[model samples]
Target chain A: MEDDYYSIDSILSENQKIQCTFKVDIPDMGHLDGGHERDIKAQSKIQLPLWLAFILIYSDYVDFAVPTPFSSRVRNALNAEAKSVRLSALVGAGGHWYGFGKIIMRLLDDAQANEMSDLLTKTFRDRLAEVIDQAQHFAALGPAGGGGQSGDSALAFREGLEVTERELFSLAQESAKKTKQWYESTDRLRR
Target chain B: MALPVSLRNSITPPELELVASEELVEIIPLISIERTAFISGAYGPLRPPNKAKLPLWIAMNLKMKKKCHIVPPDWLSVDFLQNRLAQETSRPEFSEFPFRFAEIAKLLLDVASDDIQNSDKVRSLLKDIREARQAKSRDGLQKIDHSELGLPNLCSMEINEIRPFFVRAMGVLTHLTRDPEASSRRLDV
Candidate 1:
């Protein structure tokens, strides 16, 4: 369920508004407002989904500001958390942790990156440590059982689970691996 | 005493409810035909050596007819499942795995046990984990607090199997969170 929630969160988060400025001049780009059509004029600005923004930005077709969630406000808050509670709260609040991390990591991998890149790296490291710690606590529980029901009662109710939290754990590992790969590739490029 | 209201209400969204429903299965169909008509669309009278991608249901049907060989997913292998079981048993944290892994393995074990090299090992390992989780659930019912409901082994376990445990856990979570006096009484005990 956490996996589904995050997966949905990631998809929804991609649609969050981001400010973008066009560099090239092209005609008939959709209408942005009542009178003004989206002309691909130099220095033209607009708001678009982060997904589209990433593609356009990567292609050098446009430039954009990092959204508020990935800004210092978030980093500062994350830095303040003594445990994973805040990070879990962020996920619980319908935030896409991995999707956001991937975007920031990609930003860090950019050659002409700024101070925000370093901030992202630190935020991710701290957040990940917290997540791992939280997972470790859950891990300590062994598996679901031994509370109210016991012995024969437990065996009587075995039909296999419909969905498991395993996918959530798997997704976390996947995001970690991707982040690691992004770091390694960037390091390789730098050398 | 209890999980916060925000945490308790984070139930499964309908969109992700069918994670394993449409898993594509590879099959080498023995019979050759142009196409078969279904409500959605038409599919090929697939031929041998030319593998067809069909839904698990369709593949199962074809497998039943002896018309095709259902190629099992990579993770369904005996070695991998055994290794996964070992890792899950020994490690505190669960590693990444395919969604519906347990269900898929169970299906494979039922339909094509011979295909797997260590079928016996896989079967026993799964059984052991199942029994352990069931026992844990029985104990979990006694302890109502969220902290006492540790299910690390059930981390990646299938949901339906643990439904009763969660039902009880949720009831306890709701009861304790809504009523501080109840939690205080439990703590006092």
Candidate 2:
């Protein structure tokens, strides 16, 4: 099952164990505090192997969802490497690593930013089902059955379903609005 | 007489209407349709299970049932059953569970051999369990544990840096779902 889902073999086949060097442009951290600026400047050039890059990307998702002490170690390792390299050197060594990492990271960031949109889509799907289900349930009760007053009861049930449906629809719409907001924000970030 | 005429006109008897009884029966179909739709609709996207690895699949279902409280005492037994099967198949055995599949299978085979009359029933039950297990293996494969599966340490990255990678992974998932060809292939499986 894991093999089917991950296509680990395919990933391995595509894996390129190429040595890559890249210069990271470290913006002048004059605005930052003394130690922080120095730290940022020193760790400007980023160099990592392809395998490490994959691990880093995979770890990002895992860490985002569940923060653990182990995640901190990985984060520190990446940061420590980044901090150690000079910014000018990072910019100088442009290789597959830098290009590939940038593209993948950017795509990932876009998806993460649009999480609310995904949530909205899910909510919309759920609400649509809920509304239709409630409507049918009420209709099922019918106009007559319960103690000869089933007509009244059915009518009441229908009204209740209608109210609930309306509420769900409204909630879905709100979700949609939030999704739109997220989409716009993500679009800006991507740009 | 003129004064009493106004009061008499105001007083009227209530009317009762008899509704058709057949209309009541319509409720059953309505409820059925509603229930079906409700269930179908509840599943956001349906992915079919793979047919291969029938034994392992059964083990997973047994595991799921154990988790969901559908089968209580059987959870441990199911875990043992899975280990035994894994060992029998020479598959990569799960590290966590204590009992191996071979042991459980041997025990079951021995019990069935002892009770010749119930052997068929045992075989039949075993088959059913295997089918159930296979049903969920595909989904289980797709399921990713965000914490444990990936790189060792990720928590220390800044939120700004982390957000992008997370989005990318989700984008990949979304793309996988949206691809009609891939989805159809999965469904066919």
Candidate 3:
């Protein structure tokens, strides 16, 4: 729940430092006619290394940090939807608009894109429900009151934590692998 | 690290040694520019430049030094530097360069301390070096050969030890072109 693993602060600081250092303006080299003479001048001001930039940009969807204005706009839109849905007369209409717009729209439109969106929504919802169920079950089994049953409950909680950690690691590994493959495929296009 | 005795004692090939010495001397200022740019928050990105640009920048700087040409006036434009710094800091990468961000940072600090302590001497030296280089180009004469300048031979242990640093500096230049923002950020850091 804390999201401590992401270290967003460190990443942000690092980003700021990078911004201060490298001058990224590329001069229009097309007009320079001389061979190496022109090439050297053009070469001097390049900011990022091509291979690294290529890798970072093409790496993964989740890795993409939304540019500032877009993020703020999206947040405002989501907030507006939540307000409108809460005020609606129809039962569950607010939830539908605030939470399940893509799903309800797909169910109504019955188009291919909608269907895909529905499928994804359903999958995510099911997975989230499963996680909540597991957590609730553990929480219901209150702290040990000094008995064999209590000891068993503690063991169960420990096991659950281990399982969850493992799942998180597996997810991270899978994401990294997918990103690597995506980068490799896109790198070919740049060449 | 102290140079190996064999390298220290070995006589350098006159031509190649001369070239190497000249390269070493010319490289100092380029390194200075990079360091200054970095400390002044001019280096764009925090990340290292890509491999291609690294070598190219080094080669270009070397050529410029050899030709006694000034870096284009626009090279250090503020807007360009700021943009590049933004990019580099936003992304981090693994590189083959021997020194990482921490090492480079330390080196820069050491250089800055030494430079500030000898500000006038360094400034005068820089002015003379630039003037001499410019004069050579204007007079249509070959510049002072490395040996004539009393530089240590290219094959000398001291020079060899400094080679990697030069390569790293060159790599920074290359990164500047590829991810200016990242490079700029790294410099700022």
Stronger candidate by lDDT (2 vs 3): 2
Residue-wise C-alpha lDDT for candidate 1, range B68-185, written one tens digit per residue: 7777777766677667667656654544466566555555565656556677787787666554444444444334343344444353333443443344334323322223343346
Once fitted onto the true fold, the runs of candidate 1 whose alpha carbons sit more than 4 angstroms away are A1-191, B1-21, B35-45, B129-157, B178-189
Q: lDDT by residue for model 3 over B81-156, one digit each (tens)?
A: 3443444334332111111221221222222323233334433433343233222222221122112222221223
Per-residue accuracy of model 2 over B1-189 as CA lDDT, tens digit each: 665531332211110001110011000010111111232132112112211111222222322333111111132243444554454345332223222322233222332233223444544444444433322221232343233233222111111222322333233334222233443464354
TM-score of chain B of each: 0.63, 0.24, 0.18
Looking at model 3, residue A49 earns an lDDT score of 25
TM-score, prediction 2 = 0.19
- lDDT, residue B82, candidate 1: 69
Fnat computed for model 1: 0.00
Better of 1 and 3 by DockQ: 1
In model 2, which regions exceed 4 Å deviation? A1-103, A106-191, B1-102, B107-112, B115-117, B142-145, B148-189
Q: What is the TM-score of chain A alone in each candidate?
A: 0.49, 0.20, 0.21
